[model samples]
Target: MSNHRQAKDPRLQKISSQLAAHGLILRGGFVFGDGEAALEPSEARPAKSVLLVGQAGAAPWPYFLGWREQQPRDLQNPLDTWSREVIDMVAAHFSAWTVYPSDKPYQPFQQWAMRAEGLKPSPLGILMHPEYGLWHAYRGALLFADEIPIPDIHDPIHLCDQCVGKPCLKSCPVDAYSGDGFAYQSCLAHVRGTDGEPCRAGGCLDRNACPYGTGYRYPADVQAFHMASYAGL
Candidate 1:
């Protein structure tokens, strides 16, 4: 596709509205460059007209549970269906496009979001949605061909600040989280040695203890997948 600039497109607004109706929230920003080059404009990639990111909530939890129990041959079939629906809606507005889901490997994302954009490294256990807590996961991202108005970036709500119980910090059996940061090695060793015994049985106590995300809880299997990957198992 030509990199020529185009006028602001009305279809972008319509697409965002449609996605919101489908329960997907949108965030927009341009991707940046790698490392120190990130601070310099010369290192930047061609600014895409606009980028769309979508987040889904606890609505998919029960489906995830059923799929895990059934162990379907195509594990991702259901998620793929959901992702495709969103992508199609975005394609209606943009000609050339790219879509990314959270289940994809994290390395590329780190490079793209941090190194490229010059964004600071995300906190060890920080989850995206404040209201949903860590229970929610990003479903997909869409890129467009024309600049679209983006919502203002809001300060992340630090639910931990107001939490009285502080269950997430105390719930980990291994005490993997310190008030300052995560005890990465301790958490990894515990998960690997025990085959994720405690976590697989009851999910990550830390994540489960978050009171804010009661409605956006992830399915047990989804939580397991994330824990297993974190443990490198």
Candidate 2:
């Protein structure tokens, strides 16, 4: 594929459209340096652009829940399984190389998101979205040998800046979140104990406290599902 063909490629529009049905969308994309492209040595294609595809808020939870229900009961990591299947289908549709953040080699997704989307990190370490807050997630990416026409990204205005007081840091009952960082063990223990009832029944208070994207907050059931997973239940 050549740069001249990219602007006219019908597949580009199809890829974006079809993915929306599965609640996936192209988060961002960027041209890469030759050296950066070499990061995925397993893939033979010299990547022209790395496209960040992801889920925003609970957009994918419904589709994923439905997908998991049809699978065998013994299935573990149902969300991961469903996401990989969705991502694989889209990758094939566009003839792009597939990569997941959860892959063993761990693709440099943070770098990819930073470059592709011009995203900056929030207090919780999750990359904050101006519109989505911490309610979004990068499920996978598509690496293409030829550039794909994509919208230009602008520097984001981090919502954390406008926050008068960082509620996310103070909302956790156990102080699991702070400027210092998350207390992984403390958080897990608290969420598993009687005191964790609020978090378990709803979701992480710290995450939910973010003012930017409350309208995009995951449904209670979705949040509970994630909390269950977080508790390793």
1-233 per-residue lDDT for model 2 (tens digits): 22232354566578789889999998877666545535443656577777788988899888887888899998888888898898888888777878888897887899889877888888888888888888898999888887666656679897788888998888988898776787999999999998888999999998898888877788999999999998986
RMSD per model, one decimal: 6.9, 2.7
Give the alpha-carbon lDDT of every model.
0.55, 0.82
* Winner by lDDT: 2
Q: Give the count of colliding residue pairs in each prediction.
A: 2, 0
Off by over 4 Å in 1: 1-45, 60-89, 99-124, 153-157, 229-233
Clashing pairs in 2: none
**Candidate 1 lDDT, tens digit per residue, 75-164?**
555555656666665665655355565543432443333221233322335543555566544455555433454433445656666667
Task: Give stretches of model 2 more than 4 Å off.
Answer: 1-10, 41-43
lDDT of 2 at 52: 80
